[model samples]
Target chain A: MHAIVCIKQVPESPSVGIDPKTNTLIRQGIPSIINPFDLYAIEEALLLKDKSGGKVTVVTMGPPQAVDALKEALAMGCDEAIFLCDKGFAGSDTWATSYALAKAIQSKAADYDVIFCGKQAIDGDTAQVGPGVARRLGIPQLTYVCKVREVDLEAKKIVVERLLEAGKEVVESRLPALVTVVKDINKPRFRTLIGIRKASQAQIPMLKPSDIGCEEEHTGLAGSPTEVVKIFTPEPRKGGQVIEGEPEEACETLVQKLMDAKIL
Target chain B: MAAAGTAAVRAVAVRAAGPRSRLKQRTKRYRLPNLRLDEENCTGCGACVDTCPFGALVLEGAVVRILDSCTDCGACVGSCPSEALILERPKAAGPAVDLSAYKDVWIVVEYDRKGVSHVALELLGKGRELADRLGCRLAALVLGESVSHLTDELFAHGADLAYVVEHAALKKYRTDPYVETAAQLIRKHKPEVVLLGATTTGRDFAGALAAEIDTGLTADCTGLEIDAASRNLVQTRPAFGGNIMAQIVCKRHRPQMSTVRPKVMELPKRRDGHKGQVVKEEVALDDEKFLTKVLEFVKEEGSTVNLADANVIVSGGRGLQDPANFKVIEELAKVLGGAVGASRAAVDAGWIAYPHQVGQTGKTVRPKLYIACGISGAIQHLAGMQTSDIIVAVNKDPDAPIFKVATFGVVADLFQAVPLLTEKLRKRLGK
Candidate 1:
């Protein structure tokens, strides 16, 4: 069995201010890290590998600097890492980006049994790319998976539990399917000294659009269907009504205010 | 047909429609983008000057300068002939969906054996206004087992029509069955806009359904509006982890869809005896098609796991430091008779389960009284509970941002301040 995990590098600090004039984000001086949610995806893949004897392969698409994320995944015991870096892929939205990734998987890593992704990237917060890639690949997608129940290699199927509003559901999918994992699944393991040594010496392979059999038209902004027109902070409510005084006086005033609003 | 070097865009079945589409000569005010042309890449061509729709560009010697009327549509970027003109944004997002065929505004309804969720009602309240602005019908699309009875309830919240797709497979929410059923309804009716609550079920199903239908969807929107001239749905939401709000639009798509967080919209006043149309449809998805089965439901009947519906929630943060510090929070919640919640930091520290956490990754709540102890207001944390009726923050740091939104703030340590507040509340409420 071979497990393929797709990850992304996102801003370490998500609290970014927008340029009031241009209505665009000011991304200067922000550090980058592998998306927080993708850590859970990596851990889930590694656990699946440990449980059922398989190799884990990690994949990420970003600027050349994103190779660090691949190295981090390798330190966590992934067998191999692939970095997808291309200038044409810039400005790709979730829809077009998923198309590029699915094409990459189909052409380069065609020998995978399962594909894993974070439920959503914290920066984009779309959660659409996983299912979007599944659709582009014509495969079944089981998302928001919190637990892996059973892996029946003999039956060429796997069962997992998904988190719902008030309950959980046990779902079974065929082999060579995609699953988006949630954070509640597992705790990631820390890197060992030997693993760190191997990761430091590892040379991650790079893949471009031409290497992945992707078309220029479907790779970037041309294929995207939606666009962000403006960005702004919400208007401030009539704030600054803080009751000034000692703790006791403030507590008494709060209680009185609560009573006036009929909340008591 | 696209030009030789420029990228091509897909054309859909859109033609202007409805009452407002005829108002083509609309006046508007918009911020112009500053586009600086690179002299190194300039080819001394006049093509861009002719292609500028806003008349904001001119070629001077080898440098091209943009005037103030540049709307950043990037139309001239592709026609520049030379690679001199550039903007920070990407190429034109090219998919033109037909506006003539799609009409009504539709909201998806979620319910259990008990009844519908309040978020569903809240969507209808907003959906009514969007439909009215578009001069179209406001409809609620419900798919489940034995859910036809919900049609009348939708009418009370301002739905002009109820579209029901009933199937036994939909008795519980499963991704495959729900998306397939919803796709059938959407393809048949071709609603112009679709809305849903950003609940667990909605978030779980909306993305897949949008992908399946090949439509663009914005998640967790706090604002929705109709662009009068274009009749496009403008969806706004907190992005960049709630630090900045972004307005997104699928201008070329037929069904502009978005999932909004609960409590962001006002609940409409219920009008008794309001009549609306009810239509039922059948979706034939076999049980075998469902890749997953619901084995068992673990409901938080007596636990504090489900904080979304709590009338009052007392949440603690990493300021508590250790697992033992949660006793103070639990004690305070016990005194107030409210549910207990935690920030993502505390939950990640192994002090509490993920279910009891509130933030962008956890549950969103709109309790009447929300007390934050030792919680500095991260935008992600505030996104979940900022809508609470009355927020009381207890933190030792006077500069903590939590006090900015708190109705009442106590600038003291939680370990000492919480017990004092609890005792006073206990005495007043006779706990």
Candidate 2:
């Protein structure tokens, strides 16, 4: 089985600056890293590759510099990497993003049997893209997966544990399915020297809208329906009053405060 | 038809130009196509009609047509059957909101059989501050059966006005009717900021309402403030497994919307005999229009100690070891009349349920006093309780990160410390 892992790069800090004119993230000088959650997805894919003897492909959509993130994923044991980069793809919302990704997946449909993604990107915690991509591709998607229980290669079926609000449910789906993984899935392995050497020389395939048969209109800001008209940070919380007293006295005082607040 | 076809052919020709002509020739190719409608796949369910707030969709000759002045907000996409309708970006941008039209801040007072949820009142408290800062009025949108009786209560709790939407159809929580009623009320009186509780019902309702209004909404927010510079609602929530806190803003949309989790803010002090204008509005609702039926409402039986609402929480950690050993922590919690919480380690070990876990993956809490028993705080764990008013750490390791945030740090084994603490509290309380 061949697996593809979708990853994204996001700002490392919460202090992301937005361009007032465009209402878009100002990424000119901001430091970015592979979305932390996607790391677990890459790790899980590599683990599956190790057990089943399959090739893993890491794909990411961002500015040209995002190729570095794809290279990093390759160093962690992915066999190949792809970058969906173009100026037209800028300012795409989750809906348009998933459309572009789904088109890219269709371009490589013959090779891949399973697609893996982090439950949600850190910068945009909508958790909608993976499911959206699955919907666009007309494939079954199991989100918030915590563990992979079994894989029947001959039967072309995979069983995994899905994380629900109360507990986990064991779900079985066919091959060519999409699974969005959470952090508890697995601990990612560190890159070895051999893997680093291979990644340094690896040539990442850059795919554009023409290569994927996607209309240029559906790939970028032009295709995005939702818009971020404004961006701002939340106000700082008011500092709480510190109660200084002995343990017994403080406990009594706290209880009285709760009662006064009618919260007790 | 000829002119439209010629435009499409020209678009194709321009797009066919190579990457080298990246700057100039692409200008004409930037225009987006009309929203695609697959007539064969359309089920004519009228979902897009009801869901479209801007009146963008209309059925003509058994087919839906996109109107010329559509905003392309994508609200109709979720409601489409056979996935026939798709949102296509317009060649020209939609009209942007003129912020001067919006004025006061509003908080939706969400009451049920259990009375008003804490987050509503918390938002009211927060809204009061923002309204004061912006020199605007703070109003509460109260909707329920005979809810006008609670208008005085809403005014007492800091609401300058109570916009009541009372109806028999709203007696129980249902999605379609409630969203329609609330959205209509919002359209009638456009408040600059609208807040709701992050409870199950609130999340469901807020998502639909925001989608209907074609606005932005930040969910499960821990903080809210008015940007002194832009007068925008700055909503903050935990993201990425609570690794970092993200502050979001809906600048262009009116009624900057957000949902605050319970116990994240302080409830406002009530002023007795406070009076405010109660505007009663009737939402058009018929018996046949209600699609989803509520067969019955079954209340779960339990001790009824909602940890999310608990002000004082006594949480245990892995050092407690076994499921049976958790009884000591519970005893101590019971003695103090507080809810019992647990670290993710304990929850994963099956010593307690996941709801009791306090961490990034678990619930974000800001209780008045959080007692950490044997929790060697990891960053994930700290993300949940770091905002507590008073933290007391009890663990054998003196260097635990919990000590950094704890008001009083006791370096003692939880096995010894917890039982002793429980006995002391029990004796002190004469229990």
Candidate 3:
């Protein structure tokens, strides 16, 4: 089984602090790490490789600095890492990004059986790229997967449980499919000492638009259909009165307040 | 039959061709910003350079040079006093098909065995507004096995027309058949805008459909409106963990697509017997072509109300200290007839199941009231529930950020306060 996992590097922000004058995030000092959700994807891929006896390749598309993310994934036991970086790929939206990623997979690892991706990137939280890549590749998309029930490589079949709005649904799809997993899927493991040494000295290749057969018009902001016309910060919710007193007094006062506000 | 339904709603004057045609005309996938520099009228004063947020412009030799970072956002276009800067788009071949041929605003009405989802109805309310502003019709696209009967409800909820496609292949929300059926109808009967609920099924369906039709789609929009000047759908959504909001536009796409989160919009009042046109259409779908199958649906045990649809929620976090302590939270929720929620920390610690988690990764809920007990309000957790109508925080630490957004805060131990509060509420409501 050859499993390919797609990952992204996102700004590590517990909560963003706003620049009052600029009305934008103070992004200068923040460091970049692998998107938290993608860790699960990497772990799942490694687990699949561990069980099935094959290789796990991690792929990411970003600026040059994104290679650090691929290195981290390598340290987490992925066999290979590919970094897709080019001037043409800057300012790409989810549509263009997914298209570029799909093109890279086709150019580099077309023989793979399964592709894994985090349900969504934390910064964008769009969750569209997984299905978008599936569409471009003409494969089945199983999103929000919480469990991998079975992987019958002989039958070229895989069954998984995906979380929906109301409940979890067990879905079975053919091999060569794409899956976006949620945190409930599995716990991501830490980097091992041997894996870190190998990753530090690993030769990760960086692919450009030409290397992956991506057109300049289809891989950047110019190729994107949607554009952010404007950006602004939402008004913060105001903190209300804090009734600090005895537990009995606070409880009675809160219930009285709810009753007065017609919330109780 | 498809063309007949299409022709009935063809009421608008088409303008230029859809943006997809122009997209095909581009030779270079990536190019530097095509800014026309009027150097003859240039003062080289550097006002445009200062206005560029990306620092993509640098005043080189008393002339502004556009850098590779220029995103063509057109932010500096209007800052030049001498009108020396103009963001230029490529002059492509004429559009193959008229973009104006797409006339109506459509809400892809999602229904299950339980009937229409609330998010679908919420979309109708917003879709009606968008259609009204655009001076076009509001239509509902219902695709299901036996969803023909839903047209009345669609019309009652402000849809001016109903496009119903009935087939056993669409019995459940499978991506292949649903995308094929919806794509066929959309190609035949063009719509200027398509709205969908950002539910799991809707997100899955819309992403594939957008990629299939080669259009743009904005996900989990909190605001939707029509730009009066350009008649484009303006979609506003929260990004960066809800730290900021962005307004997006699909000016080139024929049908601008957007998926809105549930409970973000107001539900429209339903009018019984509200009359509208019902356009029934059919498409051929072969079950053999589908590559996926649904084996079973397992609802999480002990969750009577889905967190998204619940009116009240009582969420606990690591402050509970133990998994068994969730019983206190659960007991309070039971007394209040509310659902249980947990912070990421608690859920990560295996104190509770993932379904009951409430935060960025868990769920975004807007219940009538939210009670946060023993939870240190992480930004992610706050992002999910800050929109709830009322928040009451009970914590030992007064400085926990959760108190900042809570309508009422009690700085006390939850073990002491929660049971007392539950008892008081139970006696007051006679539960």
Candidate 4:
């Protein structure tokens, strides 16, 4: 029942503003948190670990500052945490990112039975990396998974209900498979005092490309098949009229104007 | 016998390449029939050849011969007069190609009950732009039962060519068969780019199809540009909760793919006499190839809050307090002849179903008039509706963030303001 979960660190946004004049994101003081969707993935993994009486290991690939995210996951009850952070990994798209992750899993936790990932990272929302990893590893993929029905460790099989466009479909896949879980799966547990203390003092071993057998040609933007060419802001519309008057008078004016326009 | 094609259409998805016997490969398998081309009932009318977008089947002498290019899309199965075309699910492999051979830009024309979809029409307008810039031909692949008549509309919409595929297996939108048909067309014709609508159905299977063909697909793109020097499509979309925009390109992949959200692009003007080539293609069908079946399609039940398609949307938040209070919101919507929408907070509070929620995790809506009442402007909510043409925010708090994006702002308690507005509109409209 051992599970390996992949999580990513994302900016706490929807509040973070962008500078219209500079055409840049305002991230100077905004804090970062684990991707909300990945939290569900972690929870499902921990739940499986509990049921089978085995350990759960979490992995992440990002810049050096990503260690904070790994520490947070450890604090949530993962037994082991590994971070893959190197300058070469910068600017990697979903393809290269999945390559680095799959390589790390192969090097670090090759004996694992099930590998879990969030359905998508809210930041990118491609939902490509999970399937990409499965293809590269030559394994089966079950995506948009909502519930875990059964886990037959001895039979090397697991059954789950995957959410599709219409509804849920029950699917069974041989173990040593990859699953991208959706938020409907489970609610994550908060860090406890004992778990917090253990995580705060834990030493997370950071690995580089060569350490995990990832080639330089397949680890960064150079290895990525996709490229970002240009970026511009979406045009904003003209502001509407905000009527000024007493609440009742303003309401009357709105109705009168709409009627004159034959709208209401 | 057809040459072993680079891709197989709707065959068993599992690869039995690892020395597993055909018998051993069976799982909780479907007992239904596989894709079979029954020769006894052959009419040799060559209709199947015209219906196969992949150019996989041909009428030679008097018999229909499947080519090596067959991707196994079952467009030909149901069109045969004597039921000559049949299918049987088999262990399969993916299409392998020399990337240089691919050309042109193709759009998968999707339709709803109301004929061709708005998203598909929008893509045609955008596709014409890209095709012109790249100096390549623009094409549309329309698939369905008895849908060839739409070719004239496709041509008028600016598709230089239309590939019409028809089959009984395609009467309904099924992921397995649709992707099989689409992937096989890519493998055989080798289109440089493919566009699809970023609707619920598009998002459901777009990634899986990309995986099947071993290609990259960018989802929900708001902007697309051709990189002149590289002849590549630069796909751009909002990232990190709309804080930043990321422009992505499939640098090495042969056919770059993207799913554009509906209403993001303008539709092409209809030209009454526009003409183009229409190639009819065919696909085989089998019950085993389909992973799931659609029991019944329930029309979007009660409230007409199809936020995505609505021109005017009045959304409420948790400030409404109780489910009963939604009546005021509905009243306002009814008077305006628009739809009633709610924020995630309202949906989470059990005031409404999730279909009415407007936020990042919810549906992205870009209506002409978006009125937010009793809703605190959260970034998540704004991300979904910020693109609306006219935004109006009403809240008791004067500094609520919703006002930032609103074209009109009102600082008043919704209880006093909303009902008054609704009453005035109802009286003024004689409703």
- Candidate number with greatest DockQ: 3
DockQ in order: 0.27, 0.04, 0.33, 0.09
Model 4 error, position B284 (Å): 7.2
**Per-residue accuracy of model 3 over B1-431 as CA lDDT, tens digit each:** 00000000001212211111221222333434455577787788887765443345667687877654354545566678888887654443233247789899999988876778899999999999999999999999999888888888889999999999999888888898899999999999999899999998899999899888878889899999888898988899887667667788887777889999888899999899899999999899998988999999988776644787788899899899999998899888988788999999999898888878887777778888999999989888987898899999999999999998999999999999999999998999899
Query: All models: lDDT?
Result: 0.74, 0.66, 0.80, 0.70
For B29-132, candidate 2 gives per-residue lDDT tens digits of: 22232456789988777666644323346677788865432333344566686789765444634434666888888888877556666677788888899899
lDDT per residue for candidate 4 within A1-264, as digits (tens), equals: 678898876545543454569543333333446667788888988888887889888998864445666777777888898787664565566667778888988888888888888877765666767766775665666777778888788988878876643345676667877888876677789876677667767776657789999987666545555555433334433346666777888777766655454433
True lDDT of residue B73, candidate 3: 49
Candidate 2 deviant stretches above 4 angstroms: A1-264, B1-95, B144-146, B166-177, B220-223, B227-229, B236-248, B284-305
Q: Give residue B216's error in model 1 in angstroms.
A: 0.9
Task: Please list, in the order the candidates appear, how each scores on TM-score for chain B only.
Answer: 0.76, 0.72, 0.81, 0.75
Top model by lDDT, which number? 3
Reference contact recovery of candidate 3: 0.47
At residue B239, what lDDT does model 1 achieve? 54
lDDT of 3 at A192: 80
TM-score of chain A of 2: 0.91
The residue pairs in collision within model 3 are: A216-B29, A216-B30, A217-B28, A217-B29, A217-B30
